[model samples]
Target: MNRRRFLQSSAALSLLTAADFAPWQAISAFARELDDFVRGPAVKDHPLRQVSKHVWMIFSPDGFPTPENQGMMCNITFVDTAEGLVVVDSGTSVQIGEMAIRQIRKAFNKPVIAIINTHYHGDHWLGNHAYVDAYGDSLPLYAHPGTIQAIQGVQGNMWRTLMEQWTNQATIGTRVVPPRLPLKNGDELKFGDVTLRMHHFGVVHTPYDLCVEVLEDGVTLIGDVAMDHRIANMDDGSYLGTFKAYDSLEKMGSRIWLPGHGEPGAGVLKWNRRLFEGIYQPCEQAIKDGLALEETKARVLKDPRVSSQARDTKGFETNIGKYVSLAYLEAEAAGF
Candidate 1:
């Protein structure tokens, strides 16, 4: 069948399979079902929530599945300074972005002089238009050059697919607004007393994955790089690269980690890195042993390291299975 027909068929089959499973069966099921859509509803309580003295986290309950439960959350930190405000990743939607702006205004009257996009993912950058469109071109937005390309490349498809999947609304056409300044690795942005160092690890989670480290606060807002110990999404073809990025973060030990999803914590970098190495390495090794796919999966599932995190293992297993299939294809290509 043609590509379009195949995608349609696959989508239908997936929907059917999901219907058979329990509603809210697992985060994996929810994510797969909502893969094409932007997560969460708009939250509108301003007056920024203070995560730290110098760091204020504007919580946008946008991507959360439930209105009361804050799941797919995004955070923006503000540094108290005379220069201007430094905002981190914008949430998934226009409403979320606007809400965050209102909160930022309450905390500091100064203009948001700069914004650092952690990556080009829609949830992170889609709300950017809301900021620029409101503040005019005065405020500069920074991201890796790869981020600019990815955003521009997926603009049309992102608008169409997101509307169809999330809101169940169809669009005739759509346009994407790009960020202002393209950032490079080691780029330093300063606002009054706060200084943020941008680090670009090429092609990790995404082609332009960027991490923002607040020197004074000692907090690092890692886009989607060091996420919670759930299944890592690799639909964008950066599975191996993502694992490598996780390794790098482990080495750069930090006190606090602000991930894209879940609550912020300390020492999560070590936990996340260990999980990737323990899980991915053995799985890759099992494939090399010429084990059948099912057998390999069963062996990995029963392994002590795997069973420890098995409660959150469903999504990991699903993603790893796909990775295994892809690895097999690569081996075949190499005439293995």
Candidate 2:
């Protein structure tokens, strides 16, 4: 049979040609099924929610690291400018990035002028593959210098390990793509119609972290420094610096806030502050009482005030203890 007939006859088209279309002929129907199984709702259900005229957000609820969400436990924000588009944080995998691109196409056909990663985490920047696939090397990714260093160094390896462990076939085509452009504190970037004010709160969520404030939209993408419903993950940061970062964010006076995770994007600074203080004070008292890490963890978890902040997610339970232990360590290292 001819290649087309063989394809129509349901032969494995791999035997036909080395052409890209051959692969599609073989797997198109099955691929659609698999894609549906892995990916979340189409543009209709998870459509980008508008924060402002220029600012839009896609919020991903906390859940297992499936292909559907691509470990995008955090929210992704995009800004439309007069020139093109600016993505606040890419998704967790190549597929997620492609989905971001599709969503962008659904709204605007402009080129992505920049993708600014608030930090080095893969969930925030790994979806770079989609942009890279579309624009190739011309796509300029911006982040703090520390972000590049960490991803190029140890944290990059850590993310790979975690994705492999948690995701199913979701992470199959995704790999780490670190940012290329290094941004500094107080740097002003004018891209189309919006100006980005990149603010770095010293040694907060990550040693190299930043929050992008959209000067035109009056919205600030505060990265992971603040979260809603879930207690902040203390796996890669400091208790003292977080409080300081919160102080800085609260003073930004932006009309709207976008967190790495959460809904509505408003009052994030206040909610994170309350959770941070609630967890910190008890942690300090435990350290002052000469409690060990384990004891401090126990005290923090049992504390009626902060216990409510620990959230439960699919395949994972919020371990408030880790936050407590990290807080104790940060306090001890700073001699506070």
Candidate 3:
């Protein structure tokens, strides 16, 4: 059989196996079986904008996934190296990656030789499917060890499920493709003429957010550790740790900081830092004053730093309270 036939057979077999498991699984499998000939909906192609000499980005204006956006929420970056193209954060799904591939081919002639997943966030890496399809499966997928482990564990499937729900099944049919290679802090990878230096400082966005610096370009792709206008999800993050990261990252002196969300610019880190401080500082003070979480939330809202950016920040009204609450709890724990 040809490669295409083999892949089709494997897919059909997987669906058949799932059909034997449970009532829900059987129903899902039956639905997939009915649509076995159809592929997942392809995401509309977003134009790639060049950030620096070697880096280009497919910017997603939406910060959160919705049925309309179809999980195109995170920024997908590409580094054009002499060796081949290096993908930073593949994207949210197979369809998204497929769209990115079209965009990349339109702008650059180089093939994608490697993929770097910034973290285990589904939005950041689930699009590994399209890359693996376009390039061979041997394409090296790199991530911090903790990120690799998390994606290979429950976080991988959990994110796939979450994206499907968030996009109203638009991201359905995306497989969990975890990064196979583990990178550590201070590791330097030379992709032909361009050099990539990895930076991981304890816990910021997640326990293993990896920032890739394009040394020659003087650009660092800081993952979800910092977002432009959107407040980062602090469910597995630390305000103190994030502050420390900002301090260290600033010292790195990269002229341009590219975030996983939002446009890349010189002011990216400072913008996120000021907004985070607005949310976290008040919570820290509230803990000192023995104030309640509700009071802390009010204080955070009243802070000029946060309030000024409220209208511009996506999901600020809906997410700030939760971010403030997490910061409050972290502050309370730190006081002990």
Candidate closest to the true structure, highest TM-score: 3
| Candidate models: Cα lDDT each | 0.62, 0.73, 0.89
Which lDDT tens digits does candidate 3 get at residues 209-303? 99999999899999898889887898999999999999999999999999998888899989999999998889889998989998888899999
Candidate structures ordered by TM-score, highest first: 3, 2, 1
Per residue, candidate 1 scores C-alpha lDDT tens digits across 7-73 of 5457656766877744545545544444434333454564566656566676543433233422224
User: Which stretches of candidate 1 lie above 4 Å from their native place?
Assistant: 1-42, 60-73, 155-160, 167-175, 237-240, 251-253, 312-336
Query: Which pairs clash inside model 3?
Result: none
* Candidate 2 residue 238 C-alpha distance from true site, Å: 0.7
Summarize candidate 2's per-residue lDDT along 1-336 as a digit string, tens digits.
433234444533443444555555556665444433443222223567788988888788863365455566768888888889889888777767777777878888788888999887777887786788787878889999999888878877687557644664355445567788999999988976789899997887888888999987778888887776666666878878888887777777788888887764667777777777777777788777888888777776676556665553222154555667677777776664
lDDT of 3 at 55: 94
Judging by lDDT against the true structure, name the best candidate: 3
Residue 304 miss distance in model 3 (angstroms): 0.8
